[model samples]
Target: MSSKNSFYSIAHQVNKPENISKVLPYYSGLEIDIAYSASKKQWVVAHHDFNNTKHYSLEDWLTSFKQLYSKRKSKLSILWLDIKTLDDNNIKDMLSTINKHIPKNISIIYDLGRPLNIINKNFSYKNIINNLREIDGIGCWITKEDLNLVSKVKNQLITDKVKNTIISYGEVVDIDLEVLYKLCEINKNLQSPFSKVFVWNIQYIEEIDELIAWQEISGMIIGYKKQMWNDRCLDQLKYLNDLKVKFNRNTPTTF
Candidate 1:
């Protein structure tokens, strides 16, 4: 996907097993929280730092998801894994689990808090890991928290051969609209450092409208509170769903 196109996936963060089944059919993208479980001696799906008795094993979750997906005849475009905790001790196990569980066709996006030494290890899964440095929520290659440094970060990304990125879009500490547009323009070029740009921290209908209007974002991560999807929110989701279907028809698959 490039900045010249408006093809973007509307993703929802479903952190619970019960909710995953409920949400699988509505959205093409699902953002999940992954962490190591000491009790289970395996990876589990949960938003907390450590897995508890209530948490389900990652393998079980994926197995159930795959079964439900087949039964529902559903499709998932992206599986965004927010790595709550990762270290050298468990990296191998995590990767092995991923290789063994996830379907071959589904794409994975790893959202890590920092760079991992073994991050470059070869994996059988189709995946993309974001650049390390971050400020306010946007991940880029920089040591400081300055939006003005994005241009420099862009060059560094290209030099490092980085191809994917994630940005934050919130009312406070949000990226400037003009800067976001510039970043989008970068993807329009053949040598664009970032081929896929995903935005998160979005909380309002207007924010969704803005992304739709820009037509450059590759994906948007949305979170919901209980009883939060008002009529307008539902309307925006429908509009985004239509846009996703229309643009996906012409755009190539991206991770």
Candidate 2:
């Protein structure tokens, strides 16, 4: 794996403390989604569509994360905070809670949902960006199916304020290298070009190799669904580890 690119495990689907223990050690990044609970007036770690009865409060989840990070003393390179519901109060609360519990070592990426939602509402996008400007990174979901909407959001972020934004293309149903290359080209041309490109719901391991070849892109984060982990997933992990070793060996020694 290139130093600029990394792997992330989509632990939101499993959304359990034990699953974090199982997956955190294997990857450089962990992707988790949080939904706001109006009644509780708190953010809980759960997918948006799921019933709210079982999820862990954002505070509790972060506490568990802190304990795990301490015990392993492992480098948790990226923390992808996928905000399922965004509002002024919850956003403030979430940021405050994160700052208090999560260690400073981890880089936090705010993965906001689709771009059009922001564009449609008055001042909504700006408000979100203003809040996110303080984070290490910001990402928005994009797909080829909606180029116009994607272009609008891309143009808005090109301004000077927002930095280290990522364009996340959901799921890998098929590998269209040319299309992906073009997307990367557009990203590079942005005044504030995206610092990374991420993809989830990956089904084939070879897609990883293909995407890695595109060094023109700033960085890449490959993700897998939580429930899909099996022997093939193990194979991919092993392959990535081998690549890391090879990369380390090839670097010239500096004395």
Candidate 3:
């Protein structure tokens, strides 16, 4: 795998067909909220609150994504599916739809919410793993408020039979470096399930610098806005690319 880290922009800002063209060239990945529409009997893209009346079908989004990725050809674009709801039928339906549309060039990462609620009559972690094992990875969201729950969930995932790449979304206040360091340390000590850690909603570039300095973290997920392609964001992307090159050069080869 390339040592270069990736940047993922939240997809809601670019939910429209026309906006896809604008965001694709700048971002390496798109984090989309996956919600089930029982009325439509199809999955749609919407935030956790599910309040937004405008719904973008997952299939439509994937089609646009495939085209954009083909055109870009410079980097592997990622699709982070932030699953808002999961049941046996919906999980199967979601995976089936994804498998049909997912291209080889695009990577997939599932954000299966907290662990405690994952296993029940309708859904099981094993089932989710079996479905996603062929894809990129799977993870859960963690905030400072629920650190203990996150740790337990991570531990359980690590112990699972299928050893897919594990990732954690660190949702914190102001990109707290100290909190990030502690999270990494906990993962290392516990034989963490995660191979990557993504700090969400970062508003500034200095957080990226701090994460790179730590060397344990992997990437950042920036929330997309109208001005996402502005000079500041572009400069930050350039700096990350440079850092990736420097790190790759410094590392020794393992035959």
Candidate 4:
């Protein structure tokens, strides 16, 4: 809705929690592997394996950012609540907390591996697509982690998943041209299902952006390695924006 974008939602991988402001001007949003807590009730944005940053918790990171989120308006755009290693028991509590912490429409991306149960979720993948039942939506992530998952969807009863899930793909993964084409085709046909094409977290920012842009990915999930920021990511996004404008008239929105 805002024509605005979030650039490098990062993890507290290697940087300090406070330096986010220093580099905030460089990109749109923060996407981290983990979340940190600045205080008992507040959260800070961080993402590192587990050992590197002891204090890194999503809650603390956000708590820190809340103080300056408005001031660093243009630099950061989105926040990533990646649960690469989470359990079923935590889903409800985590989702509830995130729903409260994250600003509306800021884009919170969860791992495909995570078992999802939205508002009316029967929590069954099968029940999700009962047609008569359609509960909520699902996550479509494409990364080194999700690429295979996306590829497998065609083989799987993915249409069923798509029917009930808000699909998004591409996040910090390596992608291929052929894969992109097939994905685009799937996405094109899936528009009726309103299945979204998520392409924003690929590490090879420019490698396949052209491929990404040619397709009408439902919504993009911008990524960042706070360590590298947009030195590479920004260049790719800029190219994507330029190409979009150039072909604004003649470009086909589907594969």
Candidate 5:
């Protein structure tokens, strides 16, 4: 079966490890950025801008997250380990360090900012596809035109590779009813559940209602203002759960 058929598999990306224990139960997965310091020769988890403040060193990240990371083999969620500004050797070395010290099922997805327009156009995807064989996930920025092109590329890719052997995916679509409808249409055509949607900063509980009005996606993202975690991200999870239930309702009563 295709992998694009689920709904609002909401994900969260942040540097604060304190939030991980608090938020993981409510999320599908986590998106963490790893910054490799040329001078220090270290890979650390740092998400925000300026000086790349260390939330957790690579060891700290794996040590603290061993429980969560180890389980990816049995239950995969989007564990996006974004390595910033590294040459080929450094990237591999960092992953090696992670495996040695932090030993988890990692999928080093190159978060392509432009994917089609720039970040990954010709050889970028192939580079990762060829070099980063251990990577199990992918995320690309979305535009309608790009969406069409990527869907075609994804279709061609899976045709050659072994299914379920890897977790390659993309869901870079505009967040609108029309766009979601198109995504649904694509989901219907491809017959797969979505693996990730990288949009962030969700405020207004009502917007959650809007995005999942007719969809129940699993494995995606939701950036939240401070407001989202006021009650331990409970309100947001409630909203997502409602959507999940809506989708479940359809599973047994499809026309």
Candidate 6:
């Protein structure tokens, strides 16, 4: 890996084809919500449950990404697939479809809810991860609701032997530096699972600074809005080049 830390600044929910050209040039990647359409028998780029609501095909979205990627050939683009409706029967098809459309510059990080959801009969989390590995996809570890479940989460990661996970940064208010510190400690001891951490729901550039300065985060997924990319914010983002530093293993990585 390169000595310079690889930090991804992603645009969240840029699911439409029209937005791809606008957003790809400014960010490292795009986070797209996908749900399987039973009626259409194909994956659709949508955040809500299946309905008549306007949504583009997953193929269309990936096509748009590929076109933009061809222009920005050097950029490493990640497609964070937040699967809204994943089930056992449709997983193989979903993976196959993604493999066909995903471009060379694109990397995939998929989220399928809790890996150990006992009530979810859709599919085993580990099984989906294994399938994703076949397509060179990275699995994600979403932070849970109860703060006390840290130990349990650690055990799960150990059992799965999952390295290089994308972590979901829930509501900023719900998390503080303390929780992020503990997560870093877990990653430190575990050695590799959390080596590459991507946190979503980041609204401000200062939050980006705080996360990067602390050293645990490798990526930031900012919710997409035109005004969010104001002059000050863009300047701060550009200043991140100066902020980039090598990963510090000797010290505890903060949030």
Tens digit of per-residue lDDT, candidate 2, span 1-255: 234443343333335666666656666666777877875678787866434667788899889988988888454567777777765455767777887887766767777777765455423345556655343676777767654565577666665356666677655555455556667777667665566766653554465554544454433344355452333554555565565455332211110
Per-residue C-alpha lDDT of model 6 across residues 188-246, encoded as one tens digit per residue: 66634444655554445345456766656666666634323223434534555445443
Output the number of the TM-score-best candidate: 2
Clashes of each: 0, 0, 0, 50, 20, 1
Better of 1 and 2 by lDDT: 2
Best by lDDT: 2
Give the poorly placed runs of model 1, Cα more than 4 Å off: 1-6, 114-179, 182-191, 205-207, 225-236, 242-255
What's the C-alpha lDDT at position 23 in model 1? Answer: 58
Q: What is the lDDT of residue 45 in candidate 2?
A: 79
Higher-ranked by lDDT: 1 or 5: 1
- Where model 3 places Cα greater than 4 Å from the true spot, the runs are 1-14, 48-53, 118-124, 205-207, 224-255
What C-alpha lDDT does candidate 1 achieve relative to the native structure?
0.53
| TM-score on alpha carbons, each prediction | 0.68, 0.77, 0.77, 0.57, 0.65, 0.75
151 Cα displacement, candidate 4 (Å): 11
Residue 2, candidate 4: Cα error in Å is: 8.5
215 Cα displacement, candidate 5 (Å)? 5.1
Local accuracy of candidate 3 as per-residue lDDT tens digits, 1-255: 334233233333344555566556656666677888766667887664454446778788778767766776434356777787765366777788888887765667777766565422227355667776443676766656556665666666665543444455554335556666776777777654466666664465455655655556656665434332233545555555566565542221100
Superior by TM-score: candidate 3 or candidate 4 = 3
RMSD of 4: 7.5
Model 4 C-alpha lDDT per residue in residues 20-137, reported as the tens digit of each score: 6654564344445543232323233344334344554555555566666666544344454454434233344445555555554344444344223222243433332342213233
Each prediction's Cα RMSD? 6.5, 4.6, 4.6, 7.5, 6.1, 5.2
- Model 6 scores a C-alpha lDDT of 0.58
